[model samples]
Target: MQTPRPKTRRTFIKNAALGLTAASVLPRTFAKESPQPDMSLSYQDLPQWRGFNFLDFFVPNPAHARVKTPEEHFKWMRDWGFDFVRIPMAYPYFLDIDYSKDITPEEVYKFSEEKIAHVDRIVEAANKYGLHVSLNLHRAPGYCINAGFQEPYNLWKDQDALDAFCHHWELWAKRYKGISPDLISFDLLNEPSLREDMNDQHGKREAVPAETYHRVAKAAVDRIRSIAPNHLIVADGNSGGHVAVPELADLKIGQSCRGYWPFNISHHKAPWVYKDPTGLPPPKWPDGPEANREALIKFYQPWFDLKESGVGVHCGECGCYKETPHDVFLSWFGDVLSVLAERGIGFGLWEMTGDFGFLNSGRSDVDYEDWYGYKLDRKLLNLLQSV
Candidate 1:
């Protein structure tokens, strides 16, 4: 039997907050403002922005259980020594369309202001807490790495999709026109891999053709910069944020990489990624290309090379699931994060407050601390802060 989506069970009301007052809707349990973000670091260079990915707008449907994040998540992230939050979003969430209907291209461009304020609630909250926010289109008008929904057009192969992609970026740019780049940046897309079938999540994937990625990303970047001249734009590496794209280096944009290098270690039994998750061996640290520190360094040499060429790079997503052994997870993660930190590259762990986060991760081995009914992995938190 299939598990049910939490849309019916989540009873917490989403607050429609405005301006700095967004913080007022925070959980009554935690009463403290996030420190103002240090403007000392420039966002264009992609400062060592280490933090978690917020999912409030990632899927953006009640059926998908996505809603606005409480300001407390931001405050605690700030108090915990993390400085960034990457929000992977679905554009349609802000649109005035029925989620159950087959969406037309025309309807795709239209969005609801009231719905968008929910998004503003997140950005404004992140800003209020002094955290740098990077907005990414996990589900663009025509493309996304993971599968669940179908698009009428293919972003990688169709001009119509490309147009929609650029149009959305233009909308976002206009929406936050005067926002400082230091506080928020726009990540053009999540992971740009070519798929034979858009709805098949477990099928063999191909890296997006470099030339095609170059064209699509350039178009979106140009469109965004035209509106918000100082906005920093970053693109995920081809092939699931692993392979660096020199094809886009010439563009004045940042490139993003990932921490899930070896699926064995990072996604040992992720049900979506593996057909029979239980058949796989329990994950071990320093296996295969990660057999040693030097081997791991060699794996990311391409990313470092990209940075050397003056293109800013950051690991946009990295983390193990609740199923991975805690000790092994940290042991492997420590090396992964250290490697990225050494070269001045920052990272955003896959998620926060869910399967792959430091809160409510549901790991059997962790000595979880109680944070207002939420479980906190103090060991993992300490490991991340050490770097």
Candidate 2:
């Protein structure tokens, strides 16, 4: 049976703090005025923000080894020395009814309710553990960058879809206003790809204009900030961190930043997506560290050079696929950690336990104890400890 969505009246309280005071209000348990840094603070000023990506929530299923409650996730994250959790969510998953073909009004309302509850539980859990959390709209309410999402990227063209997207963020700002200083960041959207002039050989007609995408993103960002001031708002650069918004750059949203990292080696045999499908032979441990480090640094230089306000850099998602050799994966991580250490940039591993997770998701025959036992990966943990 599908899990029922949390009840709104029982779960959400109306007076939650948001807007400009979002980062200002702290829980009674923590100091209220302790020079708490905003997103705009220099990376050096706020040095304790080690983080990890919390998957499974968006891609929930019985087949996945599901953790029963939010508390379970927090306990594991805290024990592993993670200070922050980036919860990536897909709005489509929460729809009351399937609308993969055509969305309906009823599905929209149900989705909004489900999303609010999902955010509420996650933020509450983060606060319970005193961990910072960044809410990421991984797949916007109606669309995604992945091929699995309905094709032609209709989000840019459909008015209802765009409105539903903006409404979700506004509601979030209201629902999670004064939860905790630890709950201070919002990722506007995941990687959004748009092309202005493209060939459609079958139709013999040019596709729709690319300006629509720019307009949609700009509107969404503006709407979110207007209602939820003082929160660190992150805008994803185009795929591979290729695009930037001068207007957003000027906002200096302090915490608004970009993400980039080496995916080729890390995702060599990744099943979901890959740069090269023939699978570049996996690297050997300890020896491949230098090359991996070079790739990460080179890929991140553009964002590093941006001098705009509130524009910090983060490697939001990076990890080797589970299918790759364990020793090689560990080596790649070691190199990445070393580079992040030198640059003072923060990063969140792609997931906790799945195809790209640090822990085995039990789908494969790989022995977690023998390959990534706690002791064997101590150096990697220590690197996170340094953060």
Alpha-carbon local distance difference test for all models: 0.80, 0.55
Off by over 4 Å in 1: 1-44, 288-290
**Residues 1-387, candidate 1, lDDT per residue (tens digit)?**
998756421121111112212432222221332333434233336798899999988774545755558998899999989999998988777777788987776666656666666767788888888899999999998887877776778898877688778867876777665566777789999888888887798744679889999999999999987877776889899987789998897787888999986667788678888888766788787666547578779999999998888888999999998888888899889999999999998889988788898888878898989989899998988988988
**TM-score on alpha carbons, each prediction:** 0.87, 0.71
Best by TM-score: 1
Candidate 1 lowest-lDDT run of ten: 9-18
Model 2 scores worst on lDDT over the 10 consecutive residues at 197-206
Q: Flag clash pairs in model 1.
A: 37-130
Whole-structure CA lDDT of model 1 = 0.80
What is every candidate's alpha-carbon RMSD to the true fold? 10.2, 9.5
Model 2 misplaced stretches (Cα beyond 4 Å): 1-48, 60-70, 99-101, 112-115, 151-153, 195-214, 240-247, 254-261, 274-280, 284-292, 307-310, 361-367, 370-383
Clashes in candidate 2: how many?
Answer: 9
Candidate 2: tens digits of C-alpha lDDT, residues 220-292: 7778667655566666665433444443554443232333244555655565554456836655544555455
